[model samples]
Target chain A: NAGVTQTPKFRILKIGQSMTLQCTQDMNHNYMYWYRQDPGMGLKLIYYSVGAGITDKGEVPNGYNVSRSTTEDFPLRLELAAPSQTSVYFCASSWGMNTEAFFGQGTRLTVV
Target chain B: GIQVEQSPPDLILQEGANSTLRCNFSDSVNNLQWFHQNPWGQLINLFYIPSGTKQNGRLSATTVATERYSLLYISSSQTTDSGVYFCAVEMAGSGGSNYKLTFGKGTLLTVNP
Candidate 1:
């Protein structure tokens, strides 16, 4: 089974452009999260969902929005793309919140 | 939010050498995990040790939950082991609603073969 899958492995967005980073999992996990990692820095949470229809803000959620419409998909939306938002985005999921989270290969987004 | 700290922000080692990585947390947690991020940027879960020790191949990990510290040991390092290692922890309760990961800056290891 594909644990965590993320699409658009790479992308470049112009200023003010908007796009969505797609993530899906077949693990039947209740917890899904979005994180971004920059060079020389650790990953920071952007948003998380405990389950379908339950979403919450995370450490860095200013330029992004998320929705959990189904158990398999948790997509992150970036509105008004800014260079500051450029980084490697990862999607993860776990059976529970306080457990090991399986991560996606990551999406490298460059905003110019 | 809990605070997690990892020691030796950067490390360089020769092939066949050994290394030790440490992680310290500020609060109590029933869950703590170690992950290795390869050059391809995929995070590989190493272990989920809340206490005692676990060994997998040349890699082993130890966690002293009572003391709020954990250790990871790498033996006979190789160039493929050159990557970032992270330690994360989460508090458990109320069906783990307190579940949010706090990650350390990570230890960047460069193993020269």
Candidate 2:
């Protein structure tokens, strides 16, 4: 079974362009998160959802938006891409609080 | 939010050698995890030891919640083990609403043959 699946494994966007990073999980997890990892920097949380229709901002939520209309999907939207936003984005999910998280392969996005 | 720190920042070991990685947190936490990001940039879950100890083959991990620290032990290191090790934690929050994980800068490891 595919634990966590992320689409657009790689992408390039010009400044001010917009795109969405799609994430899906087959494991009926209740908690889903979006994180971005930059060079020499640790993964920074962007947004997370406790469950369907329940979303919350994380450490870095600017320039991004998320929606969880269904338990199986949590998509991250980039309204205005910037060079600073060019980083590897990862999608993760867990059964619930205090559980091990499963991460997707990650999407490599480069904004010019 | 909790603060996570990992050391010794960098490590180099020869094949068949053993090494230990450490992670320290600034506050109490309800969840802690260790991850290995390979050169290919794929993150692989190493351990999910919030408390006590867990072992898997050549790797093991221990978490002392009361001390706000954890240790990861790798035995008989191999070239495949070269990667960046990261420690992440989720602070203990009321009603479990605050579940965001804070990660350390990470410890870069290189295993030479």
Candidate 3:
């Protein structure tokens, strides 16, 4: 099984540029999350969706937005990317509450 | 919001040695999970122990909800086990389907062969 898949394993973005980090899962999980990991820091939640059309902000959601259009896809969008936005982005999904989460390989993003 | 802390921040152990990693959370939680992030940056789920204990091969985990702490034990460590171990938790009152996991800074483990 593919589990969770993230596109553009690596990317370089110019300041003020906008891009979308694509994430998909074949596990049919209902809960999806977007998190970013900075150097020497733990993963911080940026956004999460309980199900299709239901999205919520997480601990660090400033420069990003997420949309869950279907059960399998949860894409994160960054507008006006800044140097502070550079980090490794991870996408995760779970079947329900109190369940194990499966994470993608992650996208290493660099904002210049 | 809940805070999760893990220690020691770094550990080095020789192959065949055993080690224990600890995770402490500030508030009551409904669930706790342990993950191993390899050099390639893939978060591999190690355990989903909300309370009590569970084991898988050479790795085991225990979580005491009342005490708000969890422990991950690795037996007979190997070079392949070198990575960053993270502890994540979800607060108890996170009602509805929106479940968010708060993660600790992680404990970096280096198993020398």
Candidate 4:
């Protein structure tokens, strides 16, 4: 099973450019989350979805947007990429509250 | 907002040595987890111990909810165990609406041969 899949394992974007990080899970998890990890730092939550069509903001949500249109997909969007946004992004999914979460390989984004 | 803190920002160990990493949270939580991020940047879930202790092979974890702390123990460490260990928690929210997972800075471990 492809627990969680993230597209564009690596990407370099120019300043002001916008892009979407794609994430999909085949586990049919109800909770999905988007996080970014900076150098030598732990992952920070960007956005989360409790279920299809339900989304909420998380810590460090600035410059990022997320949508949960289906049970298997949660995509993160950067409206205006900035150098500060350059980091490794991770997508995770869990069956529900208090359950083990599965993470994607991660998307390394570089904003120049 | 909840705050999570991990001890021993960095650790160097020889193969076969054992080590323990600690995580402390500022508030009560409903979920607690440990993850190992390898050099490749893959975050692998090591344990989900909100309370009590659980062992998996050479790795084990204990969470003391009453004390708002958790411990991750690695036995007979190998070079392959080199990575960043992160502790994440979900604070208990009113009405069961908030489930945002917060992470600590993490403890970097390097096991040498």
Candidate 5:
């Protein structure tokens, strides 16, 4: 099963450009999350959704936005991408609270 | 907000050697997990031990919720085990049900032949 899938395994964005990192899960999980990992640092939460239409900001939410329109899709949007926004983005999903989370392969983004 | 810290920021071991990685949280948590990120940047879940201990083959994990700490043990390490190990936790009372995971910097492990 394709637990969690992220599109555009790698991308290069110009300054001020906007792009959406697509994420979809086939496990029918209720909770979805977006996180980014910088060089030599742990993954930091960007946004999370408990369910469809319910989204919340996480620890590092600036320059990023997320929308959960359905149970399987949670896409992250990066507006006005800047050099500081360059990082590896990961999408994760869990069955519910306190459950094991599954992560995607990750999208390596480079903002120039 | 909850704080998670992982010990031994870096470790190197010869094949067949064993090692233990520790994770400490600042407060109580409802969920605790360990993940290994391969060099290719893929995060693989190793365990979901919120409490007690669980063993899976050569890898095992123990979580002491009351003490706000967790330990991940790897036995007979291999070169493929070289990666960044991360500890993540979801605070118990952060948002009633909208729990978000907070991660520690991570422990980099390198296994040599």
Candidate 6:
């Protein structure tokens, strides 16, 4: 099974350019999350959604936005990409609160 | 916000040596997991033990909920074990609020042949 999947293995965005990172899960997990990993920094929660039509801001959601329109999809949008936004983005999903999370291979995004 | 702390930010061990990695959380967590990110940047599942101990091949993990700490043991380490290990936990109180995960800065392990 494709636990969790993310699109665009690598991406380069010019300053002020906007893009969306696609994430999907076939596990039918009720919980999904978005996190970014910078060099030396483990992983910081960027945004999350508990279910469809429900979204929440995480520790570092200032530069990005997320939408949970369907149970299988969660996309992160960068309105105006900046150099500081360059990082590896990971998508994860869990069946429940105390369940194990499955992560995607991740998308390496670079803002130039 | 919960704080997860991992010890020995950096470690170097010989192929035949054994090592232990520690993770301490500030608050109660209903969900705890350990992941190994290899050199190619793939996060592999290791363990999901909130309490008790679980073993897989040469890797084992123990989590004590009462003490809010966890320990990961690597036996007869191999060169492939060289990478960053991360510990993450979900707060018990985060029920339905969101699916946020708190991650530790991770411990980098380098196993020499």
- Docking quality level of the chain pair in candidate 6: medium
| True lDDT of residue B5, candidate 3 | 98
Q: Alpha-carbon error at B34 in model 6, in Å?
A: 0.4
Worst 10 residues of 1 chain A by lDDT: A94-103
Q: List runs of model 3 lying over 4 Å from the truth.
A: B96-98
- Per-residue alpha-carbon lDDT of model 1 for A32-104, expressed as tens digits? 9999999888788999999999998888899899999999999999999999999999999999856778889
Pull out the clashing pairs in model 5. none
At residue B17, give the lDDT of candidate 4: 100
TM-score of chain A of 4: 0.99
- Candidate 4 per-residue lDDT, tens place, B4-113, comes to 99999999999999999999999999899999999999999999888999999999999999999999999999999999999999887643335767899999999999
Q: Model 4: which residue pairs collide?
A: none
Each model's lDDT: 0.91, 0.94, 0.94, 0.92, 0.93, 0.93
Candidate 4 reference-contact recovery: 0.81
Error of 2 at B90 (Å): 0.9
Greater DockQ among 5 and 6 belongs to 6
lDDT of 6 by residue, B5-72 (tens): 99999999999899999999999889899999999898999999989999999999999999999999
Tens-place lDDT per residue, model 4, A1-112, is 9899999899999999999999999998999999999998888888889999999888789999889999999999999899999999999999987778889999999999
Chain A TM-score of prediction number 5: 0.99
lDDT for predicted candidate 2 compared with the true structure: 0.94
Query: In order, what is each prediction's RMSD in angstroms?
Result: 1.4, 1.1, 1.3, 1.3, 1.2, 1.1
TM-score of chain A of 6: 0.98
Which pairs in model 2 have colliding backbones?
Answer: none
State candidate 6's TM-score: 0.97
